[model samples]
Target: MSRRSLLRGFSGLGTAGALAALTGCGVPAAYVEAGDRSAADRSARDKSLVFANWPLYIDTDDKNTSKRPTLDAFSKRSGISVKYTEEINDNDEFFGKISPALMNHQETGRDLIVISDWMAARFVRLGWVQEMDRAKQPNVAKYLDPQLSSPAFDKGRLHSVPWQSGITGIAYNKKRLGREIKHTSELWEPSLKGKVTLLSGLDEAFALLMQGDGVDITRWTADDFHRMCDQVEKYVKNKQIRRFTGNDYIKDLSTGDVLACQAYSGDVIQLQADNPDIEFVVPEEGAELWAESMMIPNLARHKSNAEKLIDYYYEPEVAAELAAWVNYVCPVPAAREVLASSKDKDTAELAEDPLIFPDDAMRKRLAIARDITSGERVEFAKRWNAIVGL
Candidate 1:
């Protein structure tokens, strides 16, 4: 399956049934206390940690697909063997797989895992993950992006660390369109009717559209959400929106079937390499900055080793190397200089790609939207999903 498909599959616990279980009636019994969220540390004796993440998320060796350079470097330097598994294909599915172990106060048999921040919020809320010892993660303290330093769900990042960050922005075929798209309102112009698309997932789609209406996403209200939906519903009925899509938006943009669409920054970078006509724009109004984050699950045996691994990836040099391969916004700002000094021409040019290391002006326009709260999830999702036809 494509990485985008895995990134967004099934809207991960957003269905009505799942929402009911998570926030319906009284507080659920699955909540773990801070005191019970840990197990005895075994890093000194084990010298190993198991990591579970999405497929194709990390940087791999060009010559050997099986080898991950940054991970290998960490293993070589720390002498800590990593048992990495690409076992998390969908958030809700993975949650069902491990929640039993977590809620039961038993070991999950894995030390570290990565999941989107929305789902990470669920883990943090239920106290299913442990906090990192910042004293042991100096590199992360020094190099992590300020914009991602704190989120509403994980204030000051007590329980999670971002793996890679991306932008939910507008992408257009500039050459074919014969003009620039500087604002989100431009999508509604009659010239582009029936030639636009939006993301299908509620969590994936709402923020940017809300931003288009000049709403401050960091603290947007329920009324702002309903207004955005009303506008989309009108467009949908008039055929102004060609369709709602997932990662398949790439094909539509590439073939000129869709002039513009909601797109992810990393995917647009890959598309631009093959077709320079494709241009990604963080609109004048604004855009949503999002991340898939890393967390150490409760009862992990190699907690110390996992903390070391997390810090190692924060080193600018290691971050730059991974940024070159993954093409997402680097969560470590200082890595830009490391990439700028690269001996390889392609590697060096990546330093200036705003998508990878967004410049000052762009930074001002990007905001991490506050996540959909548990109280709001069921009602908001029902209305949003209904319009998207999910």
Candidate 2:
């Protein structure tokens, strides 16, 4: 069995809605007031943190459903009990759920939360999340990936830290295709007509497609967008593309109903565990490196405990445990060595998997595409949804 992040369903709804809703605004009047933003330090009183995140994100022991080893260890080590809640299924939906409280300068009741970095960009931009005290997070400061540092939205990652990072690339069945795919452009070959799928969301799809056309996604232009849109629209017209898809592409690809598609690195990793013939490729042109990040919401009551929990995960041993189970790109490079030295053979082999722990060469080719700005979100989504019919 393979596990997948709910990227297509929840992320699509939230991202599409979020981008469309937030535009040309300095900060909406609904934003949390600066003066009312800080909640009194409640760590001394509570000694517990509430964390909201996506389902199946953390490592869970197979035998025991309730016990989460890493989190339990954190609780025991720090004497801080964690109230973990898998409440964040979609970025936009979670924002809708919590924004009302934030806008009114009230605690959302969740001390910590995780959402895709693109959405994290919005929260950071709106000052909805607080700056972490780097003095307390030495492990995160030292172990965080260099490429992930200094995002345009959160320079130096003062407001957010990546919980897990992954890549957006092409995943294809090698036995079905009968050849290795080295570049994204090859998905358009005549043999693949009506058999290839792209992601449905504009943010998820545009970067890789643009990269296939030889654009540097880190600094792609509006013109670059329209050019790619023109190409995709043409492909749709000719039925060269099977259809725009969400995470559903995983099922289609696995069943040999679709040969290849735009996919997340984490999903492909699990896919390979069951179907070894399935291969994920970082195309010669490149792929987008993305992260689902952690942020402390404005006026969150257990802020200090939450910060402690965030740094706890950054410890190399803990990070290695997470990387072993979730199989995303490990944000802590030092954790690779920890996994490599593991006593468990299956766990140790994971350290060598390029998809899980991308080597320097692969890292050089992986770029975090610049996020779609609030100003461009509406126009871009309109054009994108028009073509994809989402």
Candidate 3:
């Protein structure tokens, strides 16, 4: 399955009632204290860890699908057997599955898991994950992209490390549109009415729109959010927006039914492979840079082993290998040089793909938006979801 198909929807935490239950006024007990979050060290004896992640998010052997080259190397090098499961289909579903045990101060039967940063904020707020030891992860400290090191929700990345990074930006069929779209505001051009789509998920859609209005997304106010929503509401009423979508926009754009739409950088990479006319732009106004992050959950028995595995992927060579397959933004900037030096022509060319290793100029336009706070999630999700009719 395509990565877009597995990762696009935000329905896992879509409902206001569910948002309330997870993040609203009551339920102080849902917050785990630091003192109670850790379990006794068993890594020295067990030498194994269970890692759960989204489907198609990792690199695999091209010939024998079962062979994961990098993962196998990690196991061989560290002697830490990994039981990796691609079981986290959605953030909310996975949360629901393991939350019962976590809330009750029990093992989640897994050491580490990956989820989007917005959802990672929820886990960080509730302290459902443990702080990683940077001392044990020197490569992570040395090579992690500076842009991803500090997010509002996890300053200095105390509890999480990005597995892969991507941009949420405007994508258009340059040939079909007969013009380039340089700004988010261009999506609203009269000629483009009924031919443009926006992402339906509230979390996925809002920041890019706010950026178009010249809002500084890192510290945007509720007024900024509401004003952006007001504009979208007007566009929706007038039929300017073809529809709010998930990855389905890929099909629409590909078939020429939709000329341009909000798109994920990774999906656009795959699309451009089949149709180079399709182009993803990090708007002049700016775009939201996001990550699917890895976290070691509270009371995980293999915390030490998990830390080593996280650090291992941070090695530039290993990161380059993964980036070559995934085609998402690599969180380790140094990996670009590694790929550029590859003897394989196609692999060497990936080093120049801005979508994967964003140029310095492009980096200036990318910002990690501030996360929605637990207190604000219910109210904001209610308003945004109402606009998208979710």
Model 1 misplaced regions, further than 4 Å: 12-16, 19-29
Question: Could you give candidate 3's per-residue lDDT for residues 1-390 as a string of tens digits?
Answer: 357556555733443345456455443337899999999979999999999998888899999988899999999999999999999887777776787677778899999999899989988988899999999999999999999999999999999999999999999999999999999999999999999999988788889999999999999999998899899999999999999898899999999999999999999999999999999999999999999999999999999999999999999999999999999999999999999999999999999999999999999999999987766777777787787877
Q: Higher-lDDT candidate among 1 and 3?
A: 3
Which stretch of 10 consecutive residues in model 3 shows the poorest summed lDDT?
11-20
CA lDDT for candidate 2: 0.85
TM-score of 3: 0.96
1-390 in candidate 2: lDDT tens per residue? 323447653224454464335533443435544565677888988899899988888889899968899999999999999889988766778887877567556688888999888888878766788888889899999999898988877889998999999999999999999999999999999999988998887777888998899999989999999999999999999998998886789889989988989999899988888899999999999999999899998888888888889999999999999989888998988999999998999999999999888988898888988888877887887788788886
Model 1: per-residue Cα lDDT over 70-130, one tens digit each:
9999999999999999998777778877876786678999999998888898889889999
Question: How accurate locally, in lDDT, is each candidate?
Answer: 0.89, 0.85, 0.90
Model 1 lDDT at residue 227:
99
Kindly give the stretch of ten consecutive residues in candidate 2 with the minimal lDDT sum: 20-29
lDDT of 3 at 54: 89
| Runs in model 2 lying further than 4 Å from the true structure | 1-4, 9-36
What TM-score does candidate 2 reach?
Answer: 0.95
